[model samples]
Target chain A: MRPFLFSKSSAINQALAKKNGTTQYIAGGTNLVDLMKKHIAEPESLVDITSALPAKIEVTAKGIQIGAMVRNTPLANDAIILAKYPLIAKAVLAGASPQIRNMASTGGNLLQRTRCPYFYDVTTPCNKRKAGSGCSAIPGENRMSAIVGYSDQCIAVHPSDLCVALAALDASVKVQDKSGKTQSIAFTDFHRLPGTTPERDNNLPANALIHSIEINENAFAKNCAYVKVRDRDSYAFALVSVAAALNLKDNQIVEARLASGGVAHKPWRWLEAEQYLKGKTANAATFEAAADIAIKDLRAQSHNGFKIPMLKGAIETALQQCLNR
Target chain B: MKQEYNFSRRFFLKTSSALGALAFIPKGVKAFYEEVKNFIVPKKEQLPLTVSINKKSYAIKADTRTTLLDLLREDLNLTGAKKGCDHGQCGACTVHIDGERALSCLTLAAMVPGKEVTTIEGLANGDKLHPMQEAFIECDGFQCGYCTPGQIMSAVACVKEGHTKSVAEIKEFMSGNLCRCGAYNGIVESIQKVAAK
Candidate 1:
């Protein structure tokens, strides 16, 4: 790792004031430090913002607000999350190891880079690592590449489990700039499709710090499930995951939110499928049809054609599990 | 001429002796030379940090880039935490920060000033071993022992966090600490033993 200066601040405004092109912010240091060690990231200086941001999980009149610095472990085990927003808790627990969850921050989890092999290797050609370098995953080992919302430049899928749940929950991210000005960005709009600029993972403006995540109270909390299919039963990245939330009335679906991971550049969701489920009876057949609509536009790579059926089954299963309880 | 000759001979003797003694200088003097060298070609950035570890405070000048794992093992000589996969993949460098398990290798030394860091070395009281340590020994929880310290630290946290209720729970919580020797059976048994108490 390269030698760099480290500074810490307890004030968000003061920390953001020092933000520049070469100075990166450090919180939890789970993903950033690993990237630094691999030479994938070489910032000239690191500003430790772990203490600068609020770490509390607050309940508001509209919904709940989770501070950016809140660690994953506490967020997963929080009483409110377990009782009311259980899907978020389940997704958090399904993602990483216990130690990682203890150290990873909510903001850092959203800002984490993709787990694409080429992006991490640094030697391989990856448009996400360095734009226009060419995407190796398109022609190389791409069993885990994105099957939807991908462009010719990049085929990497977003690797965040929590983001998928947040997408399903219609969560919004609140960001503050250096001047203390704040703005709320909807969760789906926050992460960007690879497009031509895979290097820019999200729509977050440079020098803006994520302050908190706002999740409004919803009826889908009780009937929600996050199903993750991975190589390992635990401590592994999802091969295809689904976060399914439904609002039901007398065996009929009143509303639905379905999002998938490991399928697209962002948390993959189809409004057409979500709209199709409304007023429909909650059963395996309806869910299978919804799953079919969700994968209608999916274009698979050479090795990831299996994901089409796998994701379809996962979607149906997630909705079925949500109906069980 | 004889006086001049004596002065020149004395100067030559002093210079020669100083040059010859450089090879056998003490370690402290050699370290000072290194400082002087760094002053000429400055590459390292140093910062003063006071960290509390195992209920003891240490004030040391650390390189700004030094991680907590490196500080404990390399600087402080507390080698219990093994540096397996310097990245966060392997849990061999697990330590407790404020009673929560964290990957020390990913934690920069600078981030730990105001926190309490407990490692495997601090798990015992006086000459008595911690119950987790005793349980590990009784159950033969390790073979190679490289990952034992980290596994023990995580197991202690797991039990405290109420995650040791079932065999599957123990296995899931302890999945971060990879034992390449496949000593998982005994490790799980050890956690169960301690949790049962």
Candidate 2:
């Protein structure tokens, strides 16, 4: 890795002011350091913002506010998260290893780049790494590439389990700019679809820093499950994962929020499927119908065509688990 | 916003003089530019880091890119924490940072300035081995013994965190530390033995 300047900032304004296009903010350094070592990310300066950001897990009147610097381990093991947002906790636990979870931060996880092999291999041409360089994953091995919301420029999927649950929970991201102007972005809109510019992952501006994530209190606590189907039982990325939460009243689904991972550039929310499940009986037939609607518009690549069936199975299983709970 | 400046005679004279001086002494100008760059931008050459390891405080100068695992093994000669993957995938580089298990390979040395690090070398009380270490030996928790240190460290933490309620729980908690020799049975037994006490 190339040598870079490192500064430890204790204030948000100081960190934001120091950041330019070539500067990156480091927190946890689990992914950033690894990417740096691979020469994938060569920032001229690194601003240490771990201590600069708030680390609190505050329970506000609207809902829960998770600080950006909160580690994945604590967030997964937090009592309130386990009770109120069990899907988030389960998703967090399913990602990475225990040691990694202890070091990864909430904000860093949201901004993590793709795990596509072509993207990591600097020898290969990747549009995500270099704009208009042409994508190698398109014609090469792309079993893990996106099945929806993909462009010819890039097909890499966002490898995050936590964000999938957050999307289902209808979370919002709070970002603060250098001028101290703050704005809340809906979770569904936080990550961008890989249209023409796959180089830009999210809608976050270069100067703005993520402050915290706000999640409103929902009634899907008792009926929520995060099911990640990977090649292994643990410590693996999802091949097809489902985060299902259904609010049932008198054996009828009053509301449903379903999102999928390992399928798109952003968390793939099946709004149509969610809308179809409303007022339906909690049974296998209803779940199968919802699953069909979820995968209806999906267009998979050559190698990842199996994901359509796998996604259907995962959605069915996750809904069944939620209904059983 | 600051006002943008247009080209002027004063700016041209200032630039021409700087170029003329550099033309007269090209080597000297290059050296001066490097000196100014170094003075302005902080390089990774000599970063002052203060960390407490095994209850011993050490003030050392490290490169900004040096990982905690490299700082311990290369700088401090603490080779007990092996670097199996060095990418945070394998648990062989697991160490305690402020009593919590973390991957030293992924952690930068500069990030551990105010935190306490506990490696495999600090697990015992002089000649006496830590209870988890002893349990590993008694249960034959390792075959090749490469991943033993990390397994023991994670086992100790798993028991301490009260996650060793059953064999399944131990397996789940210790899933991060992989043993290629398939010594998982003995490893789980060792954790169970320590948890039983």
DockQ for all candidate structures vs. native: 0.53, 0.43
Return the top candidate by TM-score. Answer: 2
Candidate 2 lDDT over residue span A121-162, tens digit each: 999999998888999999999999899999989999999999
TM-score of each: 0.91, 0.93
Pairs that collide, model 1: none
Error of 2 at B144 (Å): 1.4
Query: Which parts of model 1 are misplaced by more than 4 Å?
Result: B1-43
User: What would the TM-score be for candidate 2 when compared with the true structure?
Assistant: 0.93
Native-to-model Cα distance after best TM-score fit, residue B187 in candidate 2, in Å:
0.9
lDDT of each: 0.93, 0.91
State which candidate has the highest lDDT. Answer: 1
Docking quality (DockQ) of candidate 1? 0.53
The stretch of ten residues in a row with the least summed lDDT in candidate 2 chain A is A1-10
> How far is A169's C-alpha from truth in model 2 (Å)?
0.8
lDDT of 2 by residue, B66-112 (tens): 99999999999999999998888889989999998999999989889
* Predicted structure 1: lDDT: 0.93
